[model samples]
Target chain A: MMAVTGQFMILYVIAHVLGNYTIFAGAINAYAEGLRHWPYTIILWSSRTLLLISVFLHTWYGIILKLENRKAKPETYALTRYRSASLAGRTMVWSGLLIALFLIFHLLHFTFQVIEPGIAATAHPDALGRPDVLTMVVGSFQRAGIAALYVVGVLGLGLHLYHGIESSIQTEGLNNDRTLPVVVRTGMAISVVLFLMYAAIPVSILMGILK
Target chain B: MNLTLYVWRQEDRNDKGRLVQYEARDISRDVSFLEMLDIVNEGLVKKGDDPISFDSDCREGICGMCGQVVNGVAHGPRKKTTVCQLHMRHFKDGDTLYIEPFRARAFPVIKDLIVDRTAMEKIIESGGYISVHTGGVPDGNAVLIAKRDADAAMDAAECIGCGACIAACPNGSAMLFTAAKVSHLAMLPQGRIEAGSRVCVMTEEMLKQGFGNCSNHYECEAVCPKGIKVRFIAKLYREFIKAKGNL
Candidate 1:
């Protein structure tokens, strides 16, 4: 359950990041406007519903599995030396929890506009009579603290994905001896790329490259 | 080599175990780990004190009768080696070793440094075998299995059911052991007949034995004496998915 839902969220993240790149081309407002209006809204809402369900199921099953894992090993070793398990692989629960918190804060700050209502794009329309998403996003990322927070969040995301992607593949039985090394390396590479792409937005805005 | 050992001493299954420190003096570097323990046991016997009890039989790695967590790494720090086969040369003089039994809820402590691994036996009993009609001994070349398949099956078959994989896993998952059993048989023509049902039944039994789910830590592979790969677990999942689809 965790693997399937996590893969679904990964697909959504890929699309979401690609859409986010529109901000660089100054088409974010129109993009955001198109997303909320007319037939596109149907797709938007369906995706949102699916994402919500996926997050819920992922968190729920992740918690249950973690708890069972804890119970299975009631006692810990006095001294442990990990030979193959990576640091990220060992700290999945911690990184997952951080991502959950970051997701909530991100939704409140941007999607719901509950954290900073004054800069909400929904209230201030662009010259083309569309939601000023670009203004809202730029204004938010311009802050050093928020940008740093976003960087940290994306770092957590990268760490989570570093282990999660290949784990899901293995769990789904899509990996084999011949493909294991490739799968692991590809998972790490994709995670690093996604991190750079996502972190680049806030970093560029904070550096005054995107206004 | 002299060493400081903190060995777990448990009276019985219900006793709360504690680490009791002992000084192992003048131990030869060539002696096996279990032999060093035997030396310590000899001292205890001379002193009329209760000797530290640990499990060992063949003193060789094949029997799978001896196991313990030495310095937290299952079967000690030597890679692909069981405790019985682990020599004292791996340790330095004055090295402090923390020895503990294989700890998992399913494998309760029977005594000092000994855990009851009958849970693994139960998993094996579920579906780790294939049945055949009673008849004359079949010809060896009758089943024309591919070389790759035979080699893979042999690799999986190297598992001695030592339970080190479980001890090494953070979640105490028996997926490696169970996967080895499933993969070896599933790769063979005779065992492929019931591969689907075999995987389903064995997995169910594994879960019921209080073993944890695989989280892909790959620690099991690292500590496996026979060097069983985690790919078998993936194959187990594949067989399981195929079984579910057939259902």
Candidate 2:
């Protein structure tokens, strides 16, 4: 269940990154406005609902898997050693929790306007007379502290996605000798690229490349 | 070669094990790891001290009877080698080794360096076989099998059931072991008749035996003495999903 939900979230995350690119082109306000009007609104709300279901299922299954893993080894090894499990694989729970926290923070900061109130929160209008989401993103990223948090959050996301994608493929029975290495490498490359793209927004703002 | 051994000692299933240090003096580098232990046991016998007890039968890697965590690595540091085949030459002079039974909730320590692996047997008993009539033996060529399928089946059949995968797994999962059994059978025509029901029953038995689910760490493959691959796990999943869908 976690693997299936994780695959769904991967698609959502890629779409989210593409949507965020609207900010770079200074059309974030228009994009936000576009999402709220016409047939797009139904599609938008449906995707949101689907994402919520995936998050809930993914997290609940993750906790259950963790408990099951713990029950298998009631006694701890005095000196444990890892041979093939990677650092990302070992720290999956930590990275997952970090991404969850980031998701909550992200929703509050951008969607609800309950945190990191900025120009967008004040209902400032862009040239197209829509809420200035581009300014809001810029103003938030301008601060070194907020930008650093974004960097950390994306890195955690990268770590989570790296293992999650590979594991999901295997769990879904797509892993074979011929395709296993390719799946692993492709998952890792996509994770790194996604992290870099998300990190670019905050980094570009902090570097004064964007206003 | 002289070496120091910190062997885990437990009187019974309920007894708490502790590391007891023993001096292994005048050990030969040419001897297998089990033979090194034999030298130490001889001294203990002559002194009327309780000899350290460990499991061994074939004194070869083929028998899954001998296994212990040597310096935190299952079946010692060498890849694809069991403790029975692990020679003393792999260790340096004056080296210290930490030897302990395979640790898992399902595999309890029966005595010093010996764990109860019958939990694995219980899982196998659950559904690891096919029912056949007590008739004359069928010809070997009766059931024609493709070369690819036979090769894949043999690859998974290499699992030695050493429980090293469980000891090495962070989750202590028996997925690799169970998967090997399931996949090796599922690929063949004879075993394919009951593959669906067999996988379901065996997997349920594994979970009931207190084994954890595989989290795709691939640690089992790295530590397996028989060099079993983790891809069998994927095949197990396919078999399971197919079975459930049919149900």
Candidate 3:
């Protein structure tokens, strides 16, 4: 699942980067404006639907692993009076879940606004009456605090991915001399690349490079 | 520091068991948990009292021979370590330690701090082996199992048949023990021929021994000294489902 999600996140980033390149065509804002007219764009609809499914599956398996871990070490982590273990391993669930929460908020802030540009909080019925993905992305990253939060979330994803890939192979009984090393290294590389790429996207936008 | 022991003593399999308190003097902090018990037994022996009988051998951690309900834990205080590996220092000086044999309908207490772990032996005997003939050794290269397959098998083979999984489990299930052994064999081509009967017979033997069903709680994985995971049981379920034609 570490590999699966790491690969998925990388895929999402690549799609984001490639999709962002659409602005290079002509009048990027016009493309954003044209995007609002289509009731159900093919790339928009299918990709969004697949993204939702993958997120669900990722969570579904992540929860299974967590529950299993809890069952095995009921008192080890939770009930131990000594609270000096590494905070990284201790709050693994919350850290991973924070990443999930960030992804949802990200989709809402960037993608939700594009669907129904006019929908207001209570004034609009659809509740998704918003547009301006660029502004939302720029505005969200422009905030120093929000940028820090995103940075932490990406780091959480990295830490979570680090342990998750190795654990998943061991759990799935897919460990081997040849493939285990390959899988671990690839998972590590993908995790690092995705974190850097995602970090750069926000930092670049904040620096007005996406201008 | 010496301690007071409240041990659960049962005369025989048919007899009722109850808590019997005895004071142990001058316990060494460096001694293993069982070594402390040995000191208590020596104290009883000096008075011509019946020494508390517990299961143990190869006092080193590997044999998985020593197990007890020490202070309500299946093993003692340390996580992932076995009873024999636990030392006296973890407890406070002069603390009253409660020692009890692991109890369940599946594991009937035979004496103080000792139960009939033969339930495990029986499960292994039922279907834990491959049907190979004893003769000239076959070349290892003859069987070209993938490196991955061999590694997985080795991991599953690490199960030491310690009943800690049963003791730690809320349901007293031995599914983990049986599954680990089964998985070790089932992963190889030599074992695949008997996989159908092996799972059926061993699972039946586990049930017959009055061991509880695995509900996937995974306490087995946590307390397992060998770290034999709960995933092996999931693998068992998958294989059984496949063999039963349910999948």
Which residue runs of candidate 3 sit more than 4 Å off their true CA positions? A1-44, A57-93, A114-133, A177-189, A203-211, B1-32, B41-63, B68-158, B163-179, B187-190, B196-247
Model 2 off-target regions past 4 Å?
none
Instruction: Point to the candidate with the largest TM-score.
Output: 1
- After best superposition, candidate 1 residue B3: deviation in angstroms? 0.9
Evaluate fnat for each of the predicted models and list the values in order.
Answer: 0.88, 0.73, 0.00
Predicted structure 2: lDDT = 0.90
TM-score for model 2?
0.97
lDDT of 3 by residue, A1-211 (tens): 5445544554665676556655434333445555556663666667667777777777787677556544432222111222112334445577679888877765565555542344322223222333344455555667777677778878887766655554455444454435645765676676677678667766766677764
The estimated TM-scores of all candidates read: 0.97, 0.97, 0.57
Model 2, span A75-162: residue lDDT tens:
7665678898888987888899999999898888889876765455446777767787877888888989989988999999999988
TM-score of chain A of 1: 0.97
lDDT order of candidates, top first: 1, 2, 3
In candidate 3, list every pair of residues with a backbone clash: A113-A130, A116-A130, A117-A130, A119-A129
| lDDT, residue B190, candidate 2 | 78
Candidate 1 or 3, higher DockQ? 1
- Rank all candidate structures by their DockQ, best first, as comma-separated numbers: 1, 2, 3
- Worst window of 10 by summed lDDT in candidate 1 chain B: B130-139
